[model samples]
Target: MKAILLIGHGSRAKEAKDVFIKVSNGLQERVKSKVYIAFMENATPSIEDAFVSIREDGVRYVDVLPYFLFEGIHIKEDIPEILREMKEKYDVEIEFKRPIEYHELIIDILIDRLKGAGICI
Candidate 1:
């Protein structure tokens, strides 16, 4: 089976973890694959750790999706660097996916989130 490693920029707040946990759980059910949530900083389960765990779970193919808003330095440099390290370490092949911000649905979701949070559009 395949695996998806949802990598987010980490935050100290439990509420922040809640957001990623919910997304990871949804993905786990929807994709029917092992889903792991990881962070680039300030948290456990770094991208490397997630890749290792997924590989150990018998997932030969892994796709890493950066849970970021844009192609900033973290997306361009840090994430790629981390993926490269993961690729080198893992015996199986791995693929890296683009950020979710490119998807049209994200805008719709963000608008809905704004509404849910009682923010005026």
Candidate 2:
């Protein structure tokens, strides 16, 4: 089965994990793929370790979904660094999925948040 790895900037708050889990849970159904999470820092399941676990779990393919809102250091550098290492280390091939912002629907959510905050639309 295909696998999905959701990569997020790690947070110490339990709420962060809960949020990631909730979102991942919904997405799991759509892809019918194994979904796992990793944090960039300050949380469990570092990307290197996650990749090792998935590889050990016999996952043949992976689509790494970055749980970031914008293109930053992690997206531009840190993630690709780890991914490159994982790719060479793992016998199975892998793919890093793009960030979510390419879709315009994110603007809808931002607009809604602004409206909720009493900003004039």
Number of the predicted model whose TM-score against the real structure is largest: 2
Candidate 2 ranges with C-alpha deviation above 4 Å: 114-121
The residue pairs that clash in candidate 2, if any, are none
Per-model root-mean-square deviation over C-alphas: 2.2, 1.8
Candidate 2, residue 73: Cα displacement in angstroms equals 1.2
- Candidate 1, 15-111: lDDT as tens digits: 9888888988887888876778899998777887887788778887777888888888998898888777777788656677877667788789889
The candidate that achieves the highest lDDT relative to the unseen native structure? 2
Model 1 deviation from the true structure expressed as Cα RMSD, one decimal place:
2.2
TM-score, cand. 1? 0.84
What are the per-residue Cα lDDT tens digits for candidate 2 across 1-121? Answer: 5789998898899998889878988888787788988889999889888888898899978889999978888899989988888888886577877776667898888899999999998
Model 2 TM-score is: 0.86
